[model samples]
Target chain A: MKISRIVSLVIVLIAASYFLVPLYATFQFSLQMLRGQWSFQAYRSVFADPNFLSTLSYSAVTSLVAILISTLIVVPTTYWVRLKMPRVKPVVEFITLLPLIIPPIVIVFGYLRLYGSDSLLPLTVSSAGTNLMLVIGYATLSLPYVFRSVDNGMQTLDIRTLTEAAESLGANRSTIIFRVILPNLRAAIVSGAFLTFSISFGEFVFASLLNRPAFGPYLVQIGQDRAYEPAALAVLSFALTWACMVLMQIFANAKPGASRRRRGAAFNPLARRKTA
Target chain B: MTVADDLLNPPSQGGSARSAPAGLPGAKAPRRANWAWLGLLPFALFAAFFLILPIVYLVTGAFQTPEGTFTFDNLIALTGPAILGSYWLSIKLSLVSALLGAAAGLLLSWALVLGGLPRWVRGAFITFSGVASNFAGIPLAFAFIATIGRLGIVTVLVRELFGFNIYGAGFNLFSFWGLALTYLYFQLPLMVLIITPALDGLKTEWREAAESLGASHAQYWRMVALPVLSPSILGCFLLLFANAFGTLATVYALTGSQFDVVPIMLFAQIRGNVLYNPNLGYALALGMILIAGLSNVLYLVLRSRAERWRA
Candidate 1:
């Protein structure tokens, strides 16, 4: 038993170091841009660059819009599938998982060809159209995560019962959706939104292929030419990813008041046995 | 009938009676079913415009000449030395990284779960895995470069501490092995996140039963645990393989076009007019979709099998 514990400790330590060393190295390197002394020079340079501001804002806005679009699409579809169209659940699930099968690079390649200037859609011709394409692409890439999150959320809630209750109370379709379903799904939507944000924010292939000035391509550009700045940016990116995951974890664990109140009611084993 | 009418009177209330004969139950059911399918229309349209149409276009374009005539020439061109070499290199890199990441991640997961670590350690590792698995692309490349690049801190430390240079020993961080090593940063964490639940699903009774049957520890693992866990392990391995196979930005950042992975090669084809062939580019993309699709399909099948065992 003691030997096994030691072995476990050793393995844990090794894994921990593997996860930490690159982060530590990146942070350390980020601090050493001012030759022979520790400094925040790399970070300062990154923040001060005008292109950084533009690109980061571009990515942030697009990712937020993408999150909104994904939620709008997934929530209704998942809800409808659960409440009314249960027979189509498998088809919905399969469509949601299609993004996982198709590589982003391939999808983007297809976008380039299909939505070119000569094509009927011509979404790649104008800069604004290209940005719209980027948002749409982001939405597509985040479909699986958003759908799964919302589906799991719906699974926990008795959607049919809730909808019936709302309908009996003379609630309209939109009222039930907006007031009842959306409120119950807040935690799931927020978690999925954050996941979408993280994915689309630092996304490379779509934004790059569409020739948008997003954060990902900017980071790659800096990575090519810069020394310490890329490390600083990497540290920043890691912190952002960490923040997104932590927030997602927190929201995902925040069970609705309805469920939490039910959990608190204590049940006696004797009562259960007598009932049985 | 309009969608609003269908929604206002659900199928159970015989909503389709207005569109069909009132007494014909069979006619009512099919009409109601068709209206219910309209609920999926918006989502289906979004997918068609954004995901399906674009990809289908490319899939079809893969077999067409640039002037829009049907041809197998582009697909045949995939066998040429440069393109085939890139495909081969990408596969090797993905295979090596997936194998190494799967093994390491399994070890870490085992040490955390069955190796009897404290509960908090598992929590921390799982949370870290969640973040690390998503931490990919350009920043990942930058982090790796900071750690193990030519003048990276680790390389510097190794030289100073051991009086030996890694690069002097032909250990180039821009090489294939270096890229695979970098890929492991995300790949290993992904494996951990995926395989942890499968590890948790292993019942304690199985081990105790084997022990009670006079089986030794190694024998119990070999006879009971491994066979049960094989599907999950193999599934996670395939997932990791697909994940690595589709990666582009990280490899592009690390090697800067010096190493030509298939994605990077396709990226260049799309970006530049030099040696540009649109059909060939489509074929390259079609090839990527095929490999990624096949592996993911296998992963899903294996996961279903593993899930049955768990259930």
Candidate 2:
């Protein structure tokens, strides 16, 4: 037993160093921009660069759009599949998992070929159209994560019984769907949204291929041209990824019915007064 | 039973009229099954345009010539030493890294899940795995470069403290070993995330039963535990292989397009350095799809088999 404990400690220490050292090195290197002293010069330059801000915001906005689009598409489809079409669940699942099997570069390459300028639908013609394509591509990439979380959420809540109960209370289909179902799925959707954000935020293949000035391609460009700034950017990127994971962990641990419970508590006093 | 009955017997036109006022709680209302298909249309259409069509384009374009005629010339061109070498090197790197990552990750997961560790250690490892697995691409490459590259902290520290130069020993950060080391940053964590559950699924009763049957520790592992874990282990190895195989940005950022992995090659080809043959690029993409697709298919099959054993 003692031997096993020692082994576990050794493994943990090795894995920790393996994972943490690179991060520490990157952070240290980022602070080394000034000669003979540790400084934030690299970070200052990175913040001052207009491309950094534009690309960061560009990627951020697109990631949000992608998350919204995926949620709009996946939530209804997942709800319907569970409630009405359980047989097609496997088919929907297989399609969702396709993005994982298919590399982003290959998918983007296909997009470039199929929707290039002079094609029947020239999505790559205008920058706005290209941006739309980027969002669609990101949505496709994150389909697996979004679908899985929402499906798990739906499974946890007995959707058919809930729908029946809502119907028995004179709730219409849209009301039950919009008010009753979506609220229960808030935790799942938020977790999926953060996963989508992390994916699309640092996504390089599509943005680079589609010639968008997103954060990913910008990082690659800076990595090539500058040294300390790239390290600073790497640290920043890690922090972004860390932040997303933390939010995802929090949402994953949140109770699905907590909001409903909170509402019930708030109205309990009113009910008590009426009864009295 | 109602679903099965609905499939077997369609309600007659008069039956619906007769049953309208006979509405009982036990009887299911005849659902419009066609509406279910309609509900799936948007997802299907999106996937068709973005996912399926692009692959079909690559597969079909691989067989087409510049003049739009079908030919195997592009595939034959893949047999050339240069392209073949890249494929060989990629497969080797992927296989090596996957094996190394899988073995190490399996051990780490075993230590955390089964070892007498504190609860928070496992939680921390799992959470860190989630972040680290996604923390790939350009930033990851830069992080490794800052750690182990020529002017890197570790390299400098080792040389200063131990008077041993890593680079002098012929370790180039842009080489195959360097990329494999960098690939482990994601690969190991991915393996841990995947294999931890598989480890958890191993029942304690099985080990006790084996021991009661006079089986030794090694014998129990060999006869019982390994058989159960093999499917998950193999599946995860294949997944790691595919993940490393399909990598592009990390390899591109760490070692410029100079080092030729298939993805990097395809990236360069798509960027108009296509050697005047677009079909060859298609063939390359098709090759990547085949490797990544086949491995994932195997992983899925093994995963299903593993689930069955657990059941």
DockQ per model, Cα: 0.38, 0.35
lDDT per residue, candidate 2, B1-311, as tens digits? 45434423223222455546656432534463433466677788888998999889988999999788999998999989989998998899999999989999999999999889999999889879888888888889999999999998899999999999999999988999999999898889888888887888999999999989999989998999998999999998998898888888899888878899888888889998565788898998899999988998798889888878667
C-alpha RMSD of candidate 2: 8.2
Error at B44, model 1, angstroms: 0.5
What is the alpha-carbon lDDT of model 2 when measured against the actual structure?
A: 0.82
Q: How high is the TM-score of chain A in each model?
A: 0.91, 0.90
Tens-place lDDT digits, model 2, residues A1-276 = 789889989999999999999999999988998989999999999999999999999999988888788877888888878866778899898888888787778888899989988589999989999999999988888787777777766767878788778866877666777899889889877876776677678778888889999988988889989989989998998899889878876776674653233212111110100000
lDDT of each: 0.82, 0.82
The C-alpha local distance difference test score for the whole of candidate 1 amounts to 0.82
TM-score of every model versus the real structure? 0.94, 0.91
Residue B271, model 2: lDDT of 92
How much does each candidate deviate from the true structure in C-alpha RMSD? Answer: 6.6, 8.2
C-alpha positional error of residue B290 in candidate 1 after TM-score superposition, expressed in Å? 0.9
Please provide, for model 1 over A1-276, each residue's C-alpha lDDT reduced to its tens digit, 9 standing for 90 to 100. Answer: 888889989999988998899999989989999989999999999999999989999999998888889888988888888867788798887787888777888888778878898999898999989988889988888788788777767777888889888877877677878899989989877877776676668888888879899998899899878999999999998899889878877777775644432211010000000000
